[model samples]
Target chain A: MIDIALTEEQRDCLQELINVAMGQASDKLARFLNTFVHLNVPNIELVNFDSLPADFTENYAQQNLSVVSQGFYGNEGIRGESLLIYKVNTLDDVAKILGYEPGEISDNEQLTDISSILTTTFLNGLAELIENQLSYSAPRVVSSATSSLDDHLKQLSFDWDLALKVDISYMVTDYSFDCDMVLLIPGEAVKNIQLVLERILKEY
Target chain B: MDLPQINQFLVKEINVGIIVIDAEAKVKFINQFVLSNTDLATDYQEQSLFNLFPELPEKWLKRKIESVFTLNTPAFTSWEQREYLFKMRHTRPITTENDYMAQNCTLLPMSNNADNQPELLGFIIEDATDVCFYQKQLSQTVEKLEISNRTDSLTKVANRRYWEERLAIEFERAKRHNQPLSLIMFDLDKFKNINDTFGHVAGDTVLIEVAQNVAQNLRQSDLLGRYGGEEFAIILPETDAEGALVLAERIRLGLAMHQIKVDEGTVIATLSLGVICICDDYSQYEEMITRADMALYQSKRDGRNRTTLYQA
Candidate 1:
């Protein structure tokens, strides 16, 4: 496995980039759902595939989650998969926003729709700032409400040994609706991202 | 370059519906599949998609398409997620179950040249009716299996194994919160005599009737389970010794008054119940069960058809 690490400067730059991206994404979501979307500070981590399950379980083991995943690729080796993890308990609020009766089918629909909106808006904003033109695969419902994050993470077949994991959480202001968007840039993509960060840092 | 004709033929002949719309969601190009599936006439070019299909979720679809255009990426919706984007009849012969086709749709950004930004959006609607049909059946079977696994086949209440698991969990929760929890253990009076004289089938009928009667009398939060042959147990969370004794007496009296008609003749049953409430000395749930059993023994010794509260 290749060793991947980000300097304090690089991490700070990436964090700043994610903050701006999250703001743009939340604004779009607020307009669409007519609800104030609260944003959390983006957490950046370098994760190994072996310890990924343990890391995920530490925070989300107790939660039943429905996850939507989409893959994106761009020039200069900029590629990663974005996961939108929705707590099953919060699906009722999402169903209300979508104007549907809360049930299994409606829950899955709301998860998919909201995930798509968040993933595209956030990734597009980040891609623009980084000067990379990225294209995404269709967003897919990867895990249902019956599964936990630990189980889902264990089942994943990761081709990359290491990943730059970025975590951002969104909470609806009044309602109990909360979700997390995680971006995993794997292996060589980390190096590519670092070079872009360094260039941005140099310009500063 | 020579494959343009083939490409055109492939696009038109494909089973899936393909449509290309500009930023305004007006149809720039539409294939034969979409045309055949819908009730539209010949002149459909330049028409807004919402005008073409009045049933479309205009606000949501427009936003989705706009997102794809802005991000230059594909977006997908499965039948399980939203059923279908357009209300089209499925070509499948069996149409009794589903009224409209189940669809999995993909929206892609389309660009004429490699270097230019995407100017149009392409929509591909694939028929997912067969997949959806099989998936629903599988889930239904799974749900039924899950329920049966935790339920007793004879009584339809929770089986001994599942009941014990709940008991352990509730016991720990009670200990942590220092809350009152009660357990009632009971058996039908002279149940063995009924099986010997009226046969096992009659005994089964008696057990079923007794289970139904007890279940109907309990609160929603209480769990009743068949613990052993002719023996049943109840777990009452947030209930004290007095509450447990009251429920036990209700069950005992209710059964003694009602007559169960088996194949042989009418049989009146009675119960001997042992009740135990949570105390500091009782560290584990097994200890509570043992004490409750001891109290049940006392009830049996002092004659049947009575409730005995364990003195912890």
Candidate 2:
């Protein structure tokens, strides 16, 4: 297995860049929904593909979850996937905010809507910072309330061994709605991001 | 033909509808597929898309297109999410249940030839009616399978595995909330005699009638399951000893009064039930079930067609 880890300087620089992108995403979400959004500091880690299912189950088991995943590809070999995870129970509140009636189809629509906004805005912001042009695949609901995260993760076809994982939480103010957005940059993309981070750090 | 002409020919011949629009939502170019598929006119060259399709969800579509312009990336909508972006009829030979054609639309940032910066957006709409139809059918089949997996085919009640799972869940909830809960175990008196005299079919009919009668007498919250051959169980939430005994007696009397019609002849069947209410001494649902089984055995000993509540 090829071992790849981000250095301390690269990690800090990447974290700072992610913070700015996440802030832009939250602002766009706030304007779109007409509600204030609170964002948590993003957590970054390098995880092995084999351990992903167990790690996902350990963090997000027992409770019902809905997950949406979208792929993004960019210039200079920058590519990754973005996953938006929402608790099943909190979808009703989110539906109300999006002016949708409480039902299964509407709940899915709400998830798709919010996921599109968050994924595109956040990735575009990051791509701009790195001076890379990125295009996206359509967002698809990977799993709904009926399936477990472990089962869903186990079935995913991962071509890479190691991935740089970034987790960000978005909580709507005065609402029982909070979702986690996880971005996974796999294999060569991690090295590419590290190189970009080094370049930015040198400039500073 | 040159590259631009070949590209134009391919775009026009493509099965999907492609439309190029500027930031103002004015139509710069629309392919033949879109015009041929929908009622839209060929004269919609410079007209606004919203004007041509007045029923369009202007607010949502505007935001979706604006996002692509701002982010310089592709945005997508699936039939599962929004049903359709454009309300057009499907031309498939097979009859569909949907009123309008289902669509999956993608909006991509199109760069100008002079500069590499994105100046216009391209919309590709794919007919997803067949996909939607197949997906609905598949989900319906899966739902039926799930229900069958949890239900007993003989008695049309909860099966053994599903009942035990629910019992465990209810047991934990009652313990946590300190709420009263009850379990009842019962079986037909001399069930094998009927199977021996008439046949297994007669026994099955009796079991089905008994299950239907008992289900009618129980509350909606109560769960009845076919535990095994000739044996059944119930989990009643928020029920004390008195309520449990009353329900058990009702079930017992209801079955005793009804005559089950089988292929051979009408048969009278009776049930001996054992009932138990939750108490501090009980730690698990299985223990309560064991006590209920013992009470049911006591009912059989004291003659059949009776309800017996477990003491302590």
lDDT values, one for every candidate: 0.82, 0.83
What tens digits encode model 2's per-residue C-alpha lDDT throughout B1-312? Answer: 999999989998988888899999999988888888678867888899899878787876786677677655577889987888777777774677877788998998898531254699999899899999889999999999999999999899999999999999999999999999999999899999999988998888888888998899888899999999999999999999999999899888888889888888888999999999999888989999899999999999999889899997
What shift in Å separates residue B152 of candidate 1 from its native position after superposition? 0.8
Of the true interface contacts, each candidate retains a share of 0.37, 0.46
The top-ranked prediction according to DockQ is 2
RMSD of 2: 3.7
lDDT of 1 by residue, B1-312 (tens): 469999999998999999889999898888888888878886889999889889887766776786667555567888877778888888874743667889999898888753356799998999888888888889999999989998989989989999999999999999999999999999999998999989999999999999999998899989999998999999999999999999899988988888999989999999999999999998889999999999999999998889999995
Index of the highest-lDDT prediction: 2
Per-residue accuracy of model 1 over A160-192 as CA lDDT, tens digit each? 656556777777866776677677767788788
Off by over 4 Å in 2: A7-41, A50-64, A75-77, A87-105, A129-131, A169-179, A188-204, B91-95, B113-118
Per-residue C-alpha lDDT of model 2 across residues A30-138, encoded as one tens digit per residue: 7766678888888877788887777778777787889998888988788878888887887767665654445634567667876877788788878888887677877
DockQ of all candidates, in order? 0.28, 0.40
Each prediction's TM-score versus the true structure: 0.78, 0.87
